[model samples]
Target: MHLYERLPIFVFEIEACENLTYITMAIRFNLDRTGRHLSLKDWQALPYAAREALAGYIPGDDDFPARLDQLVSDHLGRSPDTAGDAPDMAWEDTHALPPGLLAQCALADLAPPSVADWAGLTPFRRYVLTKLSRRTDKQNHCFVPAMLEFRLAQATL
Candidate 1:
């Protein structure tokens, strides 16, 4: 799996069962570097502050996955699972629209952002778009809404 697949936190939309209304699920991943999925109880057992830190952290650098493990260790007073090797991923902060993101928009037939328009985005928004584009559906459904939210794309009926 790409390291993005193992992101510690993300926001996704889920259709509400009764009304077919969409709700955002701001979920945190409880998976460890060793590929252990922490049970909900175990995740809840963690100190709230630590959980908050993990949730807000923006992953960067080669040591990031390890740093995330350290976050868990700081609170648990012990190590998180290390029984498996972590996948290598560049966690660098980016300033430009990633090629994959362009491809994603093109494949979906949306207008790709011009360089000036892309540069107007904050790093966090760029990061979210980059991650979202790499996601399931190749981000076909979510990408347009995000672009529209940023005023980078025109809305269609």
Candidate 2:
């Protein structure tokens, strides 16, 4: 059985005033390795409609990795084009941390001093590292070094 097969397909409710729309979406696959449940904001980053459609269609017997690859490809293919926008997608300091346990990774000592030293990374980068650091196994040692490297690279500029 694949990861998604074991995971649950949830109904994501987007409310507009008095109306409530439930979109069937598989927001996560592995429960233990992938960590806690994802929120609406995280799902928003993905191709929402595609996920919703696939959630109902994918067979339980299908190959796990292949299905995941297809899901990712379909999701990426449906992404909105933002060619004219700025090419860089690094994190900025302003991007707010995701709720719950992930927030704890953002505190000093957990993150590297270099990451803290960076002057003006885009919110996306901050979000990436923040999220990655929290989700990754080496919550302390790894993130600190990665942050230091990021900071060092930034300092050369």
- Of the candidates shown, which would achieve the greatest TM-score relative to the real structure? 1
Q: Pick the candidate with the highest lDDT.
A: 1
Residue 74, model 1, lDDT: 71
For residues 1-157, could you state the per-residue lDDT of candidate 1 as single tens digits? 4222443333233222112121111221123223433335544567755554444444333444565567657766666554354422211234455766777788778888887777677655665576466643455666776777778888777
lDDT of 1: 0.51
Report residue 15 deviation for candidate 2 (angstroms): 44
**What TM-score would candidate 1 get against the native?**
0.48
Instruction: Please report, as a residue range, the 10-residue window in candidate 1 with the lowest summed lDDT.
Output: 16-25
Kindly list the per-residue Cα lDDT of model 2 for residues 6-123, writing each as its tens digit.
Answer: 3333111122101112222222222111232333443354564444443444323244334434555565443322224232223334434333124334443343334334435544
Q: Pairs clashing in candidate 2? A: 90-125, 91-121, 91-122, 91-123, 91-124, 91-125, 91-126, 92-121, 92-122, 92-123
